[model samples]
Target: MAEEAGARREEAPEETIEDDDGYVEYVPVKKRRLLEQQKLLQRKGQNSSLVEDGRGAAESKPSLLVKASQLKKDQPEISATEQLVRQEKDMIDRLSERKTLMSVRELAKGITYTNPMQTDWRPPSHVRHMSEAECDEIRKQWHILVEGEEIPPPIKNFKDMRFPDPILRKLKEKSITRPTPIQVQGLPVILSGRDMIGIAFTGSGKTLVFVLPLIMLALQEEQSSSLGGGEGPFGLVVCPSRELARQTFDVVQEFTNVLREKNYPELRSMLCIGGIDMRSQLEVVKKGVHIVVATPGRLKDMLAKKKMNLDRCKYLTLDEADRLIDLGFEEDIREVFDHFKAQRQTLLFSATMPKKIQNFAKSALVKPVVVNVGRAGAANLDVIQEVEYVKQEAKIVYLLECLQKTPPPVLIFCENKSDVDDIHEYLLVKGVGAVAIHGGKDQEEREYAIASFKQGKKDVLVATDIASKGLDFPDIQHVINYDMPAEIENYVHRIGRTGRCGKTGIATSFINKNQSETILLDLKHLLKEARQRIPPVLATLDDPMDNVEEVARASGVKGCAYCGGLGHRIGECPKLEHQKSQAIAGTRRDYFGSGGYGGEI
Candidate 1:
């Protein structure tokens, strides 16, 4: 009988066991292991000197009162840390209260002013708006200009801007106390709830210029019970490319989290771009989102499928607006604009404002306040630029030689995907740690490449113009245009990726005659202004547009209506293809009118 009982016990499951209570109970193995760990930790805690006397013997830590008293006496650092935490919590609570109050005021105002088109409604009489001269002085001081209109004065710091306490504290925690030039002028305009066109160089803190105000506006609207009632997002940030959209999404998410931590309503953001599962994005939208950062195509796809809406999207921002337009997103942008019905505020931010961008802004923004930090199409002055007049065939050899001396974290921009891939492969084969990012790569590969580059896992990033604009990797030491961009403005954005946020950086370009002719004058001017070496090849080239002969011939202004010549009028001029064709046709008609060539040759 004893042997049979032993055999039965061996076969029984370990989860259920009989105790002194004479009952069976179930306990998982994981639970048992966790219990063991807890008991071991308790034993160690009790043996440590940090625990106070007279507390329970099994208690693993000191009493709050004891810890506080000791923190005040023996550890000043601990007290200061505790004070900071408390202050952060207190600020969150206070901001929450202020948000609630603002919501109530907005609700009351809505009751009185219900017109949808009344975006120009004035604030109370106590508010004193900045005068034109004052605004101009502020702009002049910062070397900025706003389109012939007065704006709210620039802020020197977060406190001067009167941002919410939580945001201010968060800024302090991040050690970003001082405002950049763009933020100094851009923030006040955005906060005024007016449409704005902000033009600043890359990495000039343009993201914050729009993001901070969007957060405040969303919070206010949320408190007033204006958002979250619809399937549409309250804010839409349209980026030119998927990488830029992803980076901007991160910034918006970080600020959104800060607002959530302040006890405000939880704000959800969705990043909609290609190279991802469309169904997954749809599901995220279905769950509810308040803000969207997206590329144009994917955003249009979502709209077509009815997965998302922009009916209630009050804040519309175009980051890198020029790039977005140049990349053939203008039609989709217009379509997206048509969906908004509410009193929406539009913001267009770009590094350069060309004529097309200016026209787009005119149609989109209603009397926008244009803010330009520096000359349009100009490169950031912080970069040390170098132009080498290398032959096309020897460009690769020169690049390899340059890499031998260049430091890590170098970014090389090729003109096309093939070159990007070839250069990346060459670098890898040479035992150099390198990664590549371009439109040709799928979403996963692009993400991994960017992640590797950003985290210092990869020392070199070989890319095309797709990585040129609005993708912030702040620590890049050098930018090399292995193949110079076709557009002058692209060169500016490409190099602006380095020398970010007042940090000095180096930018080197390989220029050949074929690539330098059209932009020689502009390149010369840029090099001279940046105090860089102007190559002898570049110095000898004349401006193609400035030559009087070339201008007269190329302007398409027909000096002679008949012959299209500058020396003679239509009647006296010789070479006229249209006139010759017409004269031949008339002779043929006269012959045909008498009797046709008909069957004859």
Candidate 2:
């Protein structure tokens, strides 16, 4: 055996190393198991003690607490750079907080001032004052959790909130017989003139929660002092996408039209979005509008050009707040905040806001009350989620069958615009009705597609992630993900297109090996939480536990608190990696959005 080995070594040209004493043969991991590497230390010409293990286990294992000092020294540049970033952020936060505090105080001066028209929002003592048993029952029935002091009771119905006759008539016409769960709790919070962060599944009537109260705010401001031309937009609804903004604009216009029909003073509201005529928007702005629903990009552009101002703007609603803060819009939002002239009654609404972003959002408000229905970032319970493993190539063929799982008005979501086009064309060629929309599509085409789908002129709507943001598609019977989204939050939003307004729906996702294990891990946890049947693929996924508790050191959190990703702790989150920031273990938030970062948002 030795002779054969010697011959093989000679034939293979084994790597030779020269030591202090003489030349020696070096073993490699490819040639031997790592544990056997220690045998090399016994070689004749090797320095046994200095080159212990030779395989470098010490260099590979994560740093031991005892050797952290040495590791810190070894990574001088990385450590120093991280420290510099941390310190700089600390300084910026301090300065920003000071300025923010001043702004908050300036806005708070007349915060207690009440609006005359807003009185209808509060019902009589019998309805306004809820008993403890009733409150508990409401919470239990709706799976609602209310936090913060002096929160108003959730209205049992529209009449309990004392809506104006116009609103009642509109509700009756639309057949919205009662306030939705979110509206039930959310309307009272905003009507109470309190800052709010509301969490509910998409299509849970969240738009009405913020929109209804803002109308009252604008009318109140106008009643006391009529707004002059080019003088006022007392309420602003900021949405993450143009589609979402347009939908919100429609909602605002619908209710505004209802009020107009009742012969109330004209309360003009307009859509401030991109792809529309700038001249037209400016004309509306010049004539003065009471409430302006806008997308951030167009809003920022208008602000930059000084075409409009928020001098009288006090009611600010961030629809799909999480998406607004994320997607590189945080700076733009802070810039918008600078335009606010008073302490605005800010409201944040979304289906899936990460805990960290929620905290970051609250930093801009005063005593914000959080009203969570079911669980934040959770899949809608009304929707049945079906996850299936399909070969990447076969997904197209299987699409036809998935459509059969549900009736008409199915929404199919793809990650790529190209895929959307491909699917839309394939469906059309196969004799199925389909409409597609993506960012690349012209504004007119996108609007047409959405309108046609909403009107039930089309049986299917194929789109990209943009459509998944916050567009409300009524009575969608099914949502099919052509490809699994990389972010689980996006997955939650995509499925939410169905199962809206307390209606049952179905969601089918086609996944394969190409998708990352981490995202699948999140999907797995989400499904488990919702009590959905775990497919065999997801059921067998092994979720690795973090050795060190990150945000949870104090609160016992076992996963990421920032993005709700369970595959990694906050320190290792890929979402935050874009910032090139490293999280120091067990530190006060100063980074992931707030203090007490360990708990759920």
Steric clash pairs (candidate 2)? 107-343
- Candidate 2, residues 376-424, lDDT tens digits: the string is 7888889999999999999999999999987899999999999999999
- On a 0 to 100 scale, what is the lDDT of residue 253 in model 1? 85
Per-residue lDDT of candidate 1, residues 1-601 (tens digit): 9898578667974446676888876777797898789888988776664445645557565789999998778854544434534543353344234322112333445522222222322333323465667656766888886673545667666776767787888888876889988888788777877778888888889998988887776676666764443375878999998899999989888888887888878777889999889887877677667788899999988887777887778888998887776565767877776566556778888886653355445545555778888766667888989888889889877887877555789999999999999899988898889999998889999999999999999999999988988999899879999987766678888999899988988898888866735455557767765678888987787543232333234432222322112232223323333435765876777466543645443
lDDT of 2 at 326: 68
Q: For every model in order, what is the number of clashing pairs?
A: 0, 1
CA lDDT scores, all candidates in order? 0.73, 0.79
- Model 2 TM-score is 0.76
RMSD of each: 35.7, 15.5
